[model samples]
Target: MAASVQGGRIGNLPAEANAFVGRQLELAEIAGLLGTERLVTLTGPGGVGKSRLALRAAHAAKAGLPGGAWLVELSELRDPDLLTNTVAQATRLTEQTLQPLLQAVCEHLAGAPVLLVLDTCEHVLDECARVVQELLANVPELRVLATSRQPLGVPGEHLLTVAPLPLGERDDAVSLFTARAAAAVPSFALTDANRADVAAVCARLDGIPLALELAAVRLRGFPLHRLLEGLDSRFDLLVSPARPRLARHQTLRTAIGWSHELCTPLERLLWARLSVFAGGWDVEAAEFVCHGGPLDAEEILALLASLTEKSIVTRDGDGAAVRYRMLDTVRSFGAEWLAGLGEVEAVRRRHRDYFRWIARQGEAEWLGPGQRMWAERLTAERANLRLAIEECLAAPEPETALELTGSLWFFWFACGFTEEGRGYLERALRRAPDGSGPEHTLAVWAHRLVTVVPEDLDAAESVSAAYVWLADERQLPVPALPLTGASLAVRGESARSAVLYGRVGQAPAADGGAEFFQLLTLALQAYLLASQAAFERCAAVAERLRTECAKRGELWMRGWGDFFVSLAGIGLGHSDEALLSAREALTAKWRVHDRLGAAAVADLLVAAQAARGEEELAARLLGISRRLWHAAGLPQLGRPDRTVFHREYERRLRASLGDARFAEVVREGWELGPDAAIALALGGVSDVSGP
Candidate 1:
């Protein structure tokens, strides 16, 4: 097992979803290759069990590697440029510097022995090749286990060809078949009477693992002879002479096509429509997006169940609400069929509409008792939401993109995907109609708010002008009011921020009427009051908001409320109270992966410590705050109002501790691992100097 390092655990491999049949030889060969080579590529066709085998190897070898084994699934990744960020996210390596992401990966794994399993790399061969090659050349101790349709072609890469199971005597294929069969039908077995027929069936299907699994699913409905007859007819129609490799690829394709042919028309339609989802979908989303044309909401569940039974779609989660997803190969086939049928536009529009409603609902209920649930749901639906956004942008009407993106203002901000949210807003803005409408104004305001990282002041100013032009001509809605106020507050216009926040009270305050809008407006109001050094008023407003948010189980806004309270406490000579408030908020922010919010809270804790004459610890935390600020891409506040306390604290710490000692202390903090840093901020420990 990987040796444990304090604060950083090594492994996060998911448990195998199904029984492991017979891959002892393949697993042993992979282990041997990993021991000798720095990069091992498992090359095979889709559904040929490359992912499964690679995952098995990773788990088997996890004990020896010290830094740990991690898996990054690249099948659903659409953008090649996000490859590094995606890997960093999978490995839980939060960036601590503005260096090139490749350099960041190298720095992270420079001295540690780690195994990185890059699954499904064929779709992104070029990008993956470049990243893997760079890391291999830079980090000597890093090993890569990649599963692709072909090799990544990097130097020092050992290719392992993963073939299908032996047909007749090895029992690998039949063992796989019988195992899956028993699940589909409890009475299923390779009895003496049926053993020959089952062997013949596996032989006819070429011993391919996925083909056998699908064939096994047929046992639920048909006897061995009937199932063999169906496969015979399907293969007779679809197959032709080819090379050994291409033939295996064709076999799996034929199997999926045969599965599609056996589905009911309603089931087939649901398959194609469900292809619109990028990830898994619950019945509610399937019904909402797939209903209305030859399919009723009531019929979707049954059809979905039928598809799951046929192994055309896989079911996940055994609760009352089961989620379903098609394999990538199957989804591709369905997408092709969906395009041929020309219902793509209608289906995609329905998908966009459903997700748009979800986003709007999230915005409405974000400050209530269901706040955390809404956050969790939005996170789960992110991939599907991306597909919806893609459809909106690609549709004839681009205004749908603008409106949908506009509805996600609070969701994006609360979830800390400000960078990605801005990219969507900018892309949608480029395609939006050049008019001053509700969506246009809303998109403009969202863009302005996202561009407020201090360095984007020029772009922020330009977008702000467009929003002001729209708001001047027409009254802005309650949700858009917070954007306007937050923009002013961050840009040092405290008076205008206060005025804009005051206008929110004039709007409707009903549960359905911009609840998050009202909630964030109050938080921003408290923030602005603190910005102006009105400590008493800031504490009063923040305390009230904190109590309300606590009642509703909202964390993001509540975290910011604690942040305001901490700031007020610091200004009011209450360092202990400030530290308590700061630590409480840090816990919440960390739970939500809100890096930007965590950075802000870290700074508050640092200041609170400085106020209490804890110079050494304060200096160390100050350095950590600097690292987090850079990681979050937020510029240092240059104005005296924001910088004076931080500057004075650093001055006092340096003067007391001496420059060299203070520099050593800050460097020690700079080397602090993520877990230790977070633990220090949360008061899990009083000191973070030890390993």
Candidate 2:
């Protein structure tokens, strides 16, 4: 089937590119589920055609549903928090409103006849289950079809366990083998002489489609008799009488092993090294991480091509930057071989070193216009970064861990990995060598900077004191002085923070007056000025910082600059401009998962709406701010100036809307939940005249 469009809308289902070989019975059965079940999950082993079956079923169900069937591919999604955003993007639900993302999804699907197909839920099964359950509970007319390696375990989920193709003489398995074999060697056919041998191969593989396909590719390399002899020997050593059920699984393992045996030693080594990656990787990454020992950079591509041709490593995308991934089963096998080879530590060290370099590169470039690219690149490499941390901790090299974690300070702050970043820093510090060295001092300072969020005043104060003590004792420059001033600002000491910020801002720049540190120092000053209600000065400083952020391609500080601009606008009585700037600020905060930043923007948005006589919308945003406060993990994380203003606006809203209706609206905002509340805040208009 091709991508269908009944109206002008192109549904999210990928075009069925290849000819689907079989599963006619399974398709019909799953299709029958469309009318009866809200949740139907197809569970099976890897390469048994769960994804294909799901696409076919979704296609068959498409015409009956006016909203159309949508498929959300979960393989590439790394962060569970992004599940709602990713689905929102896939469904093209770009209507900007003051609604939570999940609420927006619900509002879009409410009472609509739609089919949502969630594919590859195994890696994110819990998150998938939660989202699916929420969608089902909210959208009565919506149905879900999911494909996974196992059941989603949600209540009332209808399970259709997909087994291998039948092993009968004229079954789909035999047909699949014959078809793929003919593709490998056009002249090859199932003649009477070779029919028994083909049947034996299919039966031996227990009708698993991937194994049959792999064997078919070997037709050009080996004759039927020789292939059968090799399979027999591998099975004799691999198959166990005690694990008869596991024998079915052994089919794919043996096929992968056979393919491995067919590779050159260097190819096998590359394969083993490639297993270290958590997700798909490009050629540059492969060369950086996998090229060593027998494998060199130039030979890497040729060896990779050989593996791809053998169907061991799947190549995806196009052009010079094609990405590659091993099937989960294949990757697991390669990982096992890598462990046996005892090259795990050496390979992991290289992996950590490469990603460490990447972190440093990101830090250096993150203040420029390429900042977004760096952020996204690092986001994609999040899994690898975690793997590097894991390797460091396992190596018991806390010093390396400390450096790696410190290098990623900007990433953690910009990407909203506050808790996770703190955890790694604490882990490294706990295990770090006890000395008054730079490494230990940097570790302590890095921990303090992350804890400098608005919600944790105690930790912020404690760290700020430490920085002061360290500076006094060392009689030298403290790298954390900038952060110490910022933490003081968070603690409502804006006047005191301003003095310290001025001193630090005038201090000699680090790393040869790098743009990053300049930007950081400037942003801290702007926020401090805004906190002191210096509206004109704050606006000037903020506009300058925003320009620098734009010029450098920086996001985090640019976002904060927008937040302060809105604050300055409010102080200067530019309500309309404040509302607009707050939305922009909220969008920036959303991009980085900066909950505290979002909360600050939400508070400003609430006041802006109230000032513009948007009482109900203002009240609704007050609700959003409440949920945002939940995200910030404190109900009163607003800066001192903003906190008092928020209360004053709350009083105005209550007086305008009346106490009862205001309370009701606030409750409504609370019910919108954090995700939808943030979305609503993001999409809120400058003139909030609506209820």
Candidate 3:
């Protein structure tokens, strides 16, 4: 049967490009088990179609899952510590707090009936078991379907061993081979002339799906008889006599090895070097990381295209967004070759350096028109970035870890990875040498900013003192000084914070300073002005910042400027203007995936609606704001000024709409998903009915 697609449901599960040949019994059994069990694992050797079957089951079961079926691909994730974060990211949970990620994931899943497919768990088996056990224990309604080479020994777990496809007449094995062969050679068919040869090839390869698919591709270059003859010689030469009972596994490996031998020398070398990358890579990354010695940078695109045609690399997306990735089975094969060739360390270092360059470039370009593009590109490369950091930490001198982590402060802060960023920064600092240079200092400040609990006044004071000392000793302006001021303001030291902001603005402009830092200073200054009840001055500063951002096509700081202007408008009793500015700020924040900023903007929206006598909408917005704040893990960012407005709005809303009515509407709004709540706030929807 062709791949199934349920109406009215779309998710992260990838679309199957080819027909799903068979496995009726297995699919039915899996469906039955899913109905009765919370944890079902499909265990099989590599290339035996475990992942394919799991995805098919997930797509078939998507309609019954209220929270949707999300597939978390774990083949690229090497660090056990990031398992929870990976799952949270796949499920679209934007964590903005320093709270344990697993706790946040559990909370997010507790409210819905979700079907989570954890694919390829063998690399991190123990951590996967622990996380799965914890999730099942805490989230009563969540069901986990895992694909691994072995079972994840959690309690109440069900294991289903996936065997090779049957090779009987008209069986799935023959059908799969036929379908793929037709795709490879469009004129090919299962006629009497080639029927026996096709069946023999499938049986020879033990009916392993990946092995059969590889053999089918060979049909384009060789006829059926020649292909079977080649496979016979390869299997005879490669299959070891010491492992007769492991025939299926050996068959798959033999097929991969045979395919490896057929490639040109350069193709084999490129495959091994590409193994260093953790996840998918674009053409430019491939050219930079894999080009050296015999391989020229100009030849990478054609090499990648050849690899894609041969099924060694799967190409995805289109145009400038195109990416190439090897399957887990194929990547493992290449990794082994990479190790045997003694180029693992060298290639891995090259990969690290390339990603480090990417980090520096992102930092330098973060305040310009490419801000959104950078945010997206970096988010997509998250797995590779983590791998790069891991490589640095493993190096003898580990100082580069500090630089890499510190440079990503904007990604960690404004792009919704605050918790992950803090963890990396803390790790880098621990491994850093004492008396280290500017990299260490930058990391210290970044860690402080990303991990700071809004209520931690002591930490805020230390951060302030460090910046002051650094600025005085260097006799240069510190661009991040305004951030320290903002931290103080969060702790209710508004008077001291105001002084710091003023000093930073009046300080001589540093040559070639980062525009992000400059705009951030202005945004905080305007926020302080609004908090101090200087509405007109606050509006002026915010407008100036917005105009500057517009000239550069920036979004992150522009969103903050819009938010401050809304606060000033509300303070000046311009309800309509405040409402419009709040919506505008929300649009920008959502575009950049700034969950914390969007949540804060939702609070302003509540006050604006209340001020305009939209009591029912205001009450609903209050409830929506509660959910947003909970997701952000910081209510009003723990700011006294923002909290006062929130509380007063709630009190007035409660009195205007009777207590019973207010409570009812608030509950209704609280039940909405993030997208629905944001839509209501932005006036895209009239009511919060569904996401």
Candidate 4:
């Protein structure tokens, strides 16, 4: 029942992998509360089923919510500063601007009907409360459902205490245990023979879902009677008659401890080391970070299988693409053991080092055939990468933080995480020592490149001078020559920009070769040529760049190449070729979520349509490009040279159609969303005049 909004799938409540046992009453009440309450908090102890209940209730309520329900998992998120960013990402509000992240999130949800679910807020309760309060105040139609050990304490919050499932003759707890036992042992069933033992185990564990599931998995090894005996012996002493709540806590801990005692020494060690990872980790990451010292690399897969069979770690995805994660409660238990072993810092350092290697690999291979794969891989590792950066910053030497941040320039630039990259780069640079080493310089220039604003033309010039001075002093090649050229082009110094681009083209590729940068330089050079009216040379340069990108399976830079070629085609009076290249560029840009590049190509489509005598289409596309420019948070392509084509095309369109009629069509185009606008510009839609 979840609806799609602006190319983003909004209702992302994860599907249940197992059958729902019970909680009919709780589900009904939570659904009813959501219908009335603007802010609902599900407060409970660890492993008390708060998250599962929240997901179920939200999934059931998605039909009434027009904006759809979204889950923002926060168990792995350690930094309170990124709370808003995490929420915005979960809601699919990819604001490609430098504005305050909180403001961006608020504005995106301003008048929209959305159900925002914040999962696992115990660690970052203060920030969650502040964000939830701000969102409720700003967006009248927004509803929040939060799961935490405690309440967020916002003014309008309605706390729903989620207790353990009831234990009775035929209650939820026994039903859950029976279901999981059937999964572990296909012959499992309940009859009068072993029914009493099942009920006793459920009662002893306080009807908590996780403890029951863990107990059920032991059925694969021991008979029902033996499992009950183990629980009674391990848990009976911990029970306290004075405090019922404390008893439940101690019971769950003892159950988990019983599970731990069942594991082999290697499995326990791996579990403890895996606590170093944030979010989830794949098999290769586990093999690297968790192996060594009594645990061999080859033994990891088997150990993982063993732990997974015991329900200590949960597996996600399938086959080769699978990843594993532990429940916060389970991971917290393991973290305690790891700390007791005095191996926390060592394991954390290994985690940091492993991801640092990943960043470098992504950077080195970014310009090659695996660009898209690397992009997706790095995006999936965002949480772990953040953890690595945090660990590095916490260490005595923070220089590795700069190195790691700098190595991800491609991810921050080519992917749609420019705002996030800017934040990390700024932080790393702030903590960077005063050194002119290659790593420090790369971080500095990479920061400048990602955070470049057209308004800061003077700063760009200063950075360019600094790069030149550093290169001369060290007798090294200017690493980011293409960025320097881009800065010059944005400054309207076309001649100097052309010279720098030409030099970049002629220079040998940097050591440890980045073909992405080389191809990008070629694209910039072609654009410079087109702006200078050298249409023939521009077309040639663009063709070479396009061919190179095709060989590498690269889309981001190739899209720029296509745009430059389209611009040259327009200049040379080849309208058909211009339209073809423009469409290709638009498609490529849309695939990569490159909004800025898509805007440029949309503007070119306006000119191409005008050249073909499609006056009405040109006017409509002009308006669409105007809207895209606004959405992209930049004005007029961020350069005068790029704006000239738009200005000239608009003047011609206005002259052809009267001001009143042109304004009417332009207004119509401005109303189309980005997806619809791209479809219209690509000629997939014949008529967009209908509301």
Candidate 5:
């Protein structure tokens, strides 16, 4: 985990750096470091936010330091000799009695704990160093926090590197940008839909706080792609606007420009070339994508490592492989210049190929015994997947979009992304070539069925018919028509469904990669058949379907199959057996928030209680079920499922007591059917079922 930023107390930070994200660890580390070491220096490249960090730490420790604190902006100081004087002025040092100011300021500290924030000292490093060295020597109670591009090269200095924020950190750079963008456009929200571009921006800027803030601010006037294009040539593009900055902040562009001028031409070129990839690009990817006759893979990797140390390329510590990302603002600026000189298309294509290959590697891993491991691996590469989809579908390329959507389907639905999947699948079908459309449509509707099954039968039919028509038109070898037939059968189109399945026969034995639609079809058929009173056939089909989904590691579908098993347990009058399955159904319905499933399972619970002659328990459940039924929008009718519940409850209530005193209570209302049922339930009247 990274450090969290404490909001700054002393003023003058750039507006963008105000919302710090993904720095929880850094904040805690600095706070602790400041407590232990009075002289903690924050070091990083120019424009990498060292000053912002020092201010943040100082503000966080404001309460910790009772004597309060002072910010001495040293970036404005030109002469190395003036460092101590700036600190003296901020502390209200006297010109008359002060013994050479630095020593006088140290005495002014006077035993109270005080934190002195010194920002941007690289240009006047020697002077700033001399001041801090003497201050710590003379004043034991005064703490000094200095920010610079590099270390002060002084002894007793605890150097802390201030790195970039993470895109996944909702409190980080991407989130900051997205929030600012939303403020500009009310409809804008950081959805999985737009997280790719936002993360791309964060990644390109190496997640540097200042760059993300500017990119986010630019959302006010510039379209993302246009800004991205301009950012490509950042050296020429982000020109400090040649305008004055807020009184406190130097132009972030100017700060960055200084660093660019300091880098070797090769390093600068490599920096620009890296913008083509989205999210974080691994070193291997950088070498291969930005590879040229000048910089071989190994040499490019070495140069990138150097840039990492320079804080231009930020690293993500996820164990095994540490990934690197460039901040969006910086990458965009660099990419703009690189594109002007002409390298965008070649580099972007290489970036595309790298992730496309990665997607294939995920696919290969899914076929092995490590099913859970592969699922987690895909989950981790969510950013890379977004980049792949963006690189392919921003212009709606059929082949790449279709294949890319297919690879990520598992991760999407598993992670509660139904609405997002619908959007991309819609795009894929509209643009994908003739061959890719049908299979992808099948995959898309399969997920929809999982969410909308049994309730949205009408919509399910339309989606199912699309798949059927697509398959028939293509003359493709049909793999699992039974699944579709079974679904159609569930909605009472049994004749047509049976005919369709008879043509294709049952699906082959469910294997690791067999379409999930196949098992779901069998499971639904088993459930429907069991409900229609075919106990023997239902049991056989349900057992087979459960085995199939389980083998494929389809926990959700396996749970669905278990629902059918409970029906058999109910049909046989095995109360204990049914109770176990009923509890599982209870778990499943609640886990997925399936209200209808929950209501239906309540019927099973009431049945078990009635069978055991637990009148009091059954009566209490009956009352609850009545409310659940009305909530389910069920129709009121005699013999309506709920009426059956009332009759059973009253009959049990009377039988358990066999008391005449209660007979008058039931005689007025609440009984076997609606008029009689409601009457018997509410103590209005008695029915034949009532005592």
Candidate 6:
């Protein structure tokens, strides 16, 4: 542990033995995750010493990594766009091009192991997630330990959520305070004399290490109780306490301010512009904010590099595709600076414009092969989109509001963000002008999203009226925006679905292709309804629609169609065929990591098990299904009517002779057409006349 506390040092953790305490469990966890997995995120609230703890862990494990551990701090960088270059600089990489930077990073640490520490990454978490995913994909044998407020939420991310330090009944906050206080003043020991005052200081600061450290520094100037009194206006009062370290470590605010001041003017400007971003931002957003006049994206990469060199802006992880963010405290500092910059309106305008383009791209691609890709992208960009919505609402920008909401519908539905979808609709509908393209477009989107998931119909009705006018007055073609081919299929009334599908199917695609998905959906609905009318060719049409959907890679619907095909198979009296189809549906759901979809498939799986007379197997699968449903916070399907699905189970159960028993089955539904039949059937002979 021998080291000097001078300005420049390798790994930069305090060399003193007494400086590190607790985190044995955390160390073991970091060790385990890094030993096996490439990326591990240590997440907790701000000022919890995630960075210090990560530095210490890296110092401890540095020898294990022959290439030496490097810490990249990201709290100061205002632009998420340059996150990757920041890491490259931290590793002392000399590459200019992104490809070279990545290659240099990989080559430098290749065979020779290194722990890349990505610290204070919550705000730039999306960029961090992308970079981590990329690095882990490309860089072999390298590991990343990231510290953030929440998870990075990337695939295969191991979250080591750091909790506030364990406190004794008397408050570990005071113990920590006293220990750190004793470091500055040797005789400063905790006794009953000043215990109450010191304890008050710790509690007021909420057990955060930075706050505690700042509080401990006040012993040089004020009494413990006076320090407690001064915490009311914490930022102004306690942000500049006396400290042993440089001015940066004196107060929490000053520490952050010091970090920010180290950045260049462009980095500082980008940082301040980013104060408007609530959660996370990307490079594209940084370009939009930092460009236009003199400061164009033409020079953003170099500017991003300079900021990263000073350790103000940090690369999130190891990747060419990077994002950046600022800490809340740092973001606050940027906000303070941004207020006087006089480009608030212009910057916000650019923010709105960039996302409008993004929304347009999303709207165009939703029914294409990149549906899930866009779903994940929208999820990642939600914070930026939210900022756009808030900014547009406060300004003279009704169109932005409409486009923002309309662009996000697919994400809101596919990802099960039902309440979020509704909230966006309410805002868009309120802000929408009497006559505008955005208004008409978003109203339909708002309407369709509401209908898709059996949500409140109030929004749906208003949007439906808007849709009527859009077609009659504007004569806008089908699939204009919100009322796209896929959304129309999902949320539209069957009659409306038919009409819209008919129009979109005939309209030419952008590249002179066909809207085959729309046609396929219409054919399925026609075939399903036509069977009720005893149409002779209904089944044939259904089979053809399935083939066409398969040919077109209707990935989203194929999963659903699996269950529908099972029904078709049952209707055709092929029980084995139905079971196979249902099983495939369950497997697809699992493969795609769709827990909700898996739960939906669970209903089908139960039917498959029951129909085959596997009563025990049915109960077991139902048990698993219930647990999965509960975990997903979803209510169950109401008791299904025992039709071709449950008849075989009932027949076998009822006629079974001696030593056999049947129990009543319970089910859940939000009260649909099938439930009435289920209720009546279950009412007879206690749900079964079984043995």
Question: Which numbered prediction scores highest in TM-score against the true structure?
Answer: 3
Give the runs in model 5 whose Cα sits over 4 Å from its true position.
Answer: 1-33, 41-116, 121-142, 148-252, 258-270, 281-314, 321-327, 367-387, 393-398, 406-479, 489-507, 510-691
Ten consecutive residues with minimal summed lDDT in candidate 6?
682-691
Evaluated against the true structure, the overall lDDT of model 6 is 0.59
Tens digits of per-residue lDDT for model 1 on 312-364? Answer: 67677777446788655567678877999898888888888899999888877
User: When superposed on Cα atoms, how far off is each prediction in RMSD?
Assistant: 21.9, 20.3, 21.9, 22.4, 13.0, 14.1
**Residue 2, candidate 6: C-alpha displacement in angstroms:** 14
**What is the number of backbone collisions in each predicted candidate, taken in the order shown?**
1, 10, 0, 0, 42, 8
The reply for model 1, stretches above 4 Å from the true place, is 1-269, 292-296, 299-330, 426-437, 448-454, 457-518, 548-553, 590-593, 609-642, 649-680, 685-691
Q: lDDT of each structure?
A: 0.75, 0.74, 0.79, 0.77, 0.60, 0.59
Order of all candidates by lDDT, from best down to worst?
3, 4, 1, 2, 5, 6
Off by over 4 Å in 6: 1-22, 25-246, 302-322, 432-438, 455-545, 570-598, 609-691
What does candidate 3's lDDT look like per residue over 1-691, in tens digits?
A: 1112336563478787678988999999999999999999997656778888999999999888777788998877879999998998887776487878888788877666778899878768899999999989988888999987667878899988787799965799999999988988999999888788889888877687877877777777788898888875443333323342233335557546644754689999999989888778999999988999899999999988877645577678999878888755567678888899898888899999999999999988988889887887887799999999999878777679988998898888887778788789889999974745777777877777675443454555466555554455445465445566677667666788788667523532433454655676687678777666778988988998899899889998899889989988988899999999998898888778777888788888989999898999998988898887777665456463345676787889888888999999999899997777888888884332211
Return the lDDT, model 6, position 676: 35
Residue 501 lDDT in model 5?
Answer: 55
What does candidate 4's lDDT look like per residue over 107-177, in tens digits? 87766578999987866878999999998998888899998766788997998877778997588899999
Query: What lDDT score goes with residue 127 in model 3?
Result: 95
Clashes by residue pair, model 4: none
* Per-candidate TM-score against the hidden true structure: 0.56, 0.58, 0.61, 0.55, 0.55, 0.57
What lDDT does candidate 5 reach at residue 470?
42
Which wins on lDDT, candidate 1 or candidate 4?
4
What is candidate 4's CA lDDT for residue 4? 48
Which TM-score value belongs to model 1?
Answer: 0.56
Off by over 4 Å in 2: 1-47, 50-268, 299-330, 436-438, 454-485, 493-511, 591-596, 619-642, 651-691
